[model samples]
Target: MSNNHNPAKPLQSILAIMAHPDDAEFCCGATVRQMSDAGADVTYIILTNGDKGNHNLSITVPELVKTRMKEQRAAAEILGVKDVIFMGEEDGFLQPNRELRRRLVRHIRKIKPDLIICQNPEMFFSGDRYINHPDHRNAGLVVIEAVFPAAGNPMFFPDLLAEGYEPHSIRELWICMAPEPDHKIDITDLLDVKIQALRQHESQFDDLDEMEKWVRERWSEENEAGEQRYYESFKRMKFD
Candidate 1:
């Protein structure tokens, strides 16, 4: 009989997988900051180059990709993320395919994250005219699929075994910007940290005044809804 009583050891690693450079910051920044402060190791896997994000820049695809990658690395550093992986998928054209799932599964197996955070996969918006982006939805769907049988099943993705990737069962999944949220993490003290981290992506938030106002208002609304100072809300998915 094996004796294992410490539960905290199993919950150390966390993974945040998103479609674009700023998706994680916009959606779950506070949660990431809180988890990092709590000593959890967080890793990010970005699925796109975010080359199509800029509207005014006269940059080519390769140039834009390089710029966005640098921005993403800077943002990750500000958020205290330990590692980041890029999928090298084309921006604005991501699809939920077997290849993507396999790659995601491989990473999940290697990282063995206890908690996975992602954007909402559903189409409905939360009374805000801002519909979630298509790439966000696609990435979320594939991430959920990878967290399931793909990463946990030994028979699936057989090549991963040869690559030394083992089966990993994630304990919980939190989907940000979900229409219906079931879990809320109090981020009262971490709100500023989150904002500073988001500011690292200067390419996206060149209009700092407007972005700050928007984030403050949004966080205020979330605070009112939860009766807390600030929090990151999420809809918990069925993990079993």
Candidate 2:
């Protein structure tokens, strides 16, 4: 329950993989703030162009994608993220395929992140209207696969090996919105920074008033909910 980490030095390099532009901000913004504030290098890889996110807007698909990417880049700057990568896949239609997995593995090996953050794949809350997005689930599965056997196993991607991309093992993974959370990061001191970073994604949350209210309510719920401290929750993928 303490936000006191060694702030003078970088603790770890974190790579966050998500399906859309604002998914990370909505789910793990506070955790990102905490880690960045403590000098941890953070990078984000958005799997889709987020072209379908806008409603009642006159922009074309390419234009919307461009706009969202710009917004995400600005948001990353606000969150202290070192780099942002877009996979250029179509929005709302992601699939966990070998091609995507290979691409992710190459980046994983290149970045060599100490930790990776992603969305949950389980369906525990589906009945209660907490149905996970198909794109999110697919991305989560791909990320898990890429982080383990694909990225960590050099034999899995021989093309990467030929290109001098060495296999790298990540120390840990944090899945935001996990059905079962084994890790919690305290973000009380960095809540305002989280809000600011999230606000940068103007394309996703166009209604300023509604977005602010929703964020506040969610934050309050996460804090006041029993036995759940103000933190980002995740289930670590343990590979032996």
Candidate 1, residues 1-240: lDDT per residue as tens digits? 111213545447889999999889888887776667667899999999898888875677787788788888887887878998999888889998999999999899989998899977786455667766789989989999998878999999989988889898898888888766887766667778778878878878669768977888787643445564766788875454
Tens digit per residue, CA lDDT, model 2, 1-240: 355334443448989999999888877877776778667889999999998898855778888888889889887888888899999898889998999999999999999987899987664355566767889888888899898778888689899999999999987777887766776666666667777877888877768668877766666634545643355567765432
lDDT of 2 at 40: 86
> Which pairs clash in model 2?
none
Overall lDDT per candidate, in order of appearance: 0.82, 0.80
List candidate 2 stretches off by more than 4 Å.
1-11, 124-127, 221-229, 237-240
State the weakest 10-residue window (summed lDDT) of model 2. Answer: 1-10
Stretches of model 1 off by over 4 angstroms after superposition: 1-10, 222-228, 238-240
- lDDT value, candidate 1, whole model: 0.82
